[model samples]
Target: MMIGELFDPQAPLAISEHYRPHWSQAGAIVFITFRTADSIPYEVLQRWEREKNEWIARNTGRNADWRKVLPELDPRLRHQFKKTFNRLREDFLDTCNGKCVLRQPDFASIVADSLSHFDGKRYRLGDFIVMPNHVHLLASFPSEETMIGQCDSWLHYTAWKINQQLGNKGKFWQQEPFDHLVRSPEQYQYLCNYIRDNGTKANLRSGDFLYRQHDNHQ
Candidate 1:
C-alpha cells in the first residue's frame, strides 16, 4: 500500500464551494467528516451558520466572503475558528441525535463496506470510523475531481443500500461533507488518534460503532 502525501503549501490548491468551501490538493491525505441527514437539527445548524456569519462580519468586514477572508487571517485566529467549529459539531454529534440507525451493526457495516470497496484503487483509504450519526475518514486521491467523485459515489451508494434495507427514501447522508487536507505528519497522527478515540469519547459501547485502521496506514 502506498503511504499518503501531506499537503504541500507551494502546490496548486483547488478551492470549490457548495454550502461550504472545499480545498483539495492532488495526492494529499484528507480528513473528511460526513453525517446522516438528520444528525443535526435544521434550526441548530441554521443558528450556527448565522452566528458564524455574524462573527465573520464583525471580525473581517460586513459583506466579506468568509471563504476568502478566513484563509487570509492570522494562523492563530484561523486555527481558533476551525477548532471551535469542529469541537462544537463534534460535541453535538456525540449526542447520538436523530434515529442513529448507524448504531446498528448491520447498517454501519454497509457504510464500512462501501468506504472500503474502492480502498486502494481510487484512493488510499486510511483510518475511518462509523459513529452513530456520522463518519470520519482519511484518504488521498490522485486528483481533486477524483476525491469529490468518490465521496459522492460512496454517499450515494451507501444511502441507496441503507435506505433500501429500511424500505424508506429521501435524503440519507448530509449533502455537504466537511473535508480538510492534511498539512503535516503531526496532523495525520492526530486524526488517526481522533478516529480511534471517537467511540470512547462518545461513550459508546463496542457494538455501537465500527472503527478501522488499515494495516498499512501507519
Candidate 2:
C-alpha cells in the first residue's frame, strides 16, 4: 500500500499499457494531468503517436513479453523518456487555443464541482487547477482496489456533464490522461508547485484558472 513498494528495485511492479507505461501501487498519492480534446496541435499529436508507436515496437516487438521486459529496462532511460514527453506536451498546452471553452466562468465552475464531488469518498483530493483547456490534480486513492475504476468514473462523469452543458455529443476531453505516482515528498511538493503556477506559466489571466481544495490540502 505504499509508494516504496512500487519503486523497490527487486519487486515486481504492476504496469498498465497506455501511450506510456503506467505504474500503479495501492494507496498511493498520484499526480494527474489531463487535457481537452483540442489541447494539442494536430501535427504534434501525430508526431507523438508515431514516436510512441516506434518506441513500443522497438521495445516489445508486437509481443506480450513487453511486460517481462519492462522491469528489466534501465530506470534512467525510462525516466528521461517520460520527462521529455511531458515537457513537450505541457509546452503545447501553453499556446492559447482561443476556442478554449473552459475559459468561461460557468464551464470552469462545472469542472471544479465535478472534481470535488467525491472528495474524501473515493479519493483524498489535493490541490487542483482547472485551466482553460486542461486540469492538474493531486489525488490519493483510498486503496488500489478502486484506483482505475474510480479514476475512469471521475473522468467519464465530468466529461458527460460538461458535454451536456455544451449541448454537444462530441468529446470534451482527451482519451488518455498522464498519471504519475508521487514517489517522494519532494516530488509531491514539486507537483503542488507546478499546479499552483500552471496558470502563470500558461499566461492565463486571474479569472481563467480555478483551484479548489478541502481540509485535506497538500
Candidate 3:
C-alpha cells in the first residue's frame, strides 16, 4: 500500500521511549513485538493451553472450521467471539508470571486455524513466530482494510480460546503494540531474519523462524 510513498526515518522507538505515530511505508516488512505488562515470561502460557484444547475437542467434535464453528451458535456465544479480539493487540497479562515473558505455543495452532478460516478473506500474512514472552510478526496490511483490524481479529480469536479455558475475564494483551514500516529491501531482510530467528540473533530464546524474506523483493 505504501509502495511509492516516502518513509519517515524518525518513527520507530521502543515503548520505553516516547510513542510516535508511524507505520512503515507500504511494501515494507515491519518487525513488531508486544509483551505482557511488567514483562512477564510467556513460557507459562503453555501450561494453561492443554485444558482449552481438551474443551474444544469435546465440544467441537475434535476439529471443525473456525469461521463456521461459532457464528451459528447462541447469540451470546457470537458476542463472545467478537469480544475476544483487539485491534492493535489481544490480551492483557498479569505480571505475576516471571521475569521473562513466556510465549504461548497454543497461539501457533490458533494462528494456523484462523488463517485457514480466513483464507479467502482480504489478508496477507508475512512471517511470524510465537515466543515464550513475545511475538515477532512480519505481515502485510491488506489493501482492502486496516492492518490493525486484521491483527485484532486474529489475536482476539486466540485470546477468546484461552479465556474460555481460564474462565477469567479482563485484558489479555497490552493495548499498544510495537509496529514498524519497512522502507527498503535491507530493512525488510533485517526484520524477516529477526522474525524467523525470533530474537535468537540477540540471544533471545524464541522459536527459530528462518523464513525467506521474498516479500521484500516484490
Candidate 4:
C-alpha cells in the first residue's frame, strides 16, 4: 500500500493503548520519543496518569470520532487533551529525573549506536538526538514489518546493553513511547527542529548530547 493511503485519517488504524494510545501505520514517517525509566517525577506522573484516565473516560469506545470528539469536549478538558501534552512532556524532561545514565559518555554512545544501527536498513533516519534523560528521533518506516520489529529491536537492544553497562537489571526505559505520524512537510520540519533544539532547550552539555541530521551535512 502507498504510504499516504496507509496513513489516511479515515482508514482504520491499529491503535495499541496502554497509558497512551499508539497509532501504527505502515510506511509512515514517524517522530518518536522514549525516556529513561525514572525520567518523570512521581507527582507529575501521578497527575498525568489521572489526566490520561479522564481523557480515556471521555474518548472511549470503537465508534468515537477523534475529529468530533475534540470539538465536543469541554474547553478546559480539551486543552489538556489536545494542547498541553507538549508542555507536559517538556516539563517532565527538563526535570532531569532518574540517574541520568545517558549523561555518561559511554552510555550515551551506546544509545547513539543503537539508534543508528538500523539506519537505511530498517528505516530512513532523518534526524535524532540522544538527550540525557530521553531521546527523540524522526524516521520513516518502509513497511509494517520493519516498523514493528525494528522499533522493538532498537529499544530492547539498547535497554539490554545499557543495563549490562550500568550493572543494573531493573527496567532501563519507560515501557510506553510517544509516537506521532508525520503527514505533512510542515510537520516534518517542525519535528526536525524539535529534535535539533532539544539539547539546547534542556541545557545539555555538548558531551552529554549527540545530534545528527541529514539536512545539516547536505
Specify the highest-lDDT model's number.
1
Candidate no. 1 TM-score: 0.91
Give one digit per residue, the lDDT tens place, for model 3 in 1-218.
Answer: 22222234564422223332134333334545655443443444443344344444465565654445554656775554444432213233312233332344454455446634553354445566554445556555433134555556756775677567657566665545676555676676666665565445435434422223334344
All-Cα superposition RMSD per candidate: 2.2, 4.6, 17.4, 5.2
What TM-score fits each model? 0.91, 0.80, 0.51, 0.79
Model 2: ten consecutive residues of lowest lDDT: 1-10
Best by TM-score: 1
lDDT of 2 by residue, 77-144 (tens): 56755676778788878785637888888888887888788777777777888888888887776555
Of candidates 4 and 3, the better by lDDT: 4
**lDDT per residue (tens digit) for residues 1-218 in model 1:** 33588999999888886742289889999999999999999999888887777777886675665666787888887887788788899999999999999999999999999999988898989999999999999999999889888988888999999999999999999988999888888888888999999999999999999999879753
**lDDT rank, highest first?**
1, 4, 2, 3
Candidate 3, superposed: residue stretches over 4 Å from native: 1-28, 38-104, 115-120, 199-218
Error of 2 at 74 (Å): 1.9
Q: Is candidate 1 or candidate 2 better by TM-score?
A: 1
After superposition, which runs of candidate 2 have C-alpha atoms over 4 Å from their true positions? 1-13, 18-21, 49-73, 213-218
Q: Please give the lDDT score for candidate 1.
A: 0.88
lDDT of 4 by residue, 1-218 (tens): 11232246765456665432167666677778888888987888778766665565665642454545656766776766755666777767966788888888788889888878867667777788888888888767755556666667777899999888778897888877888777676677777788888887888778878888765323
Estimate the TM-score for candidate 4. 0.79
Model 2 clash pairs are: none
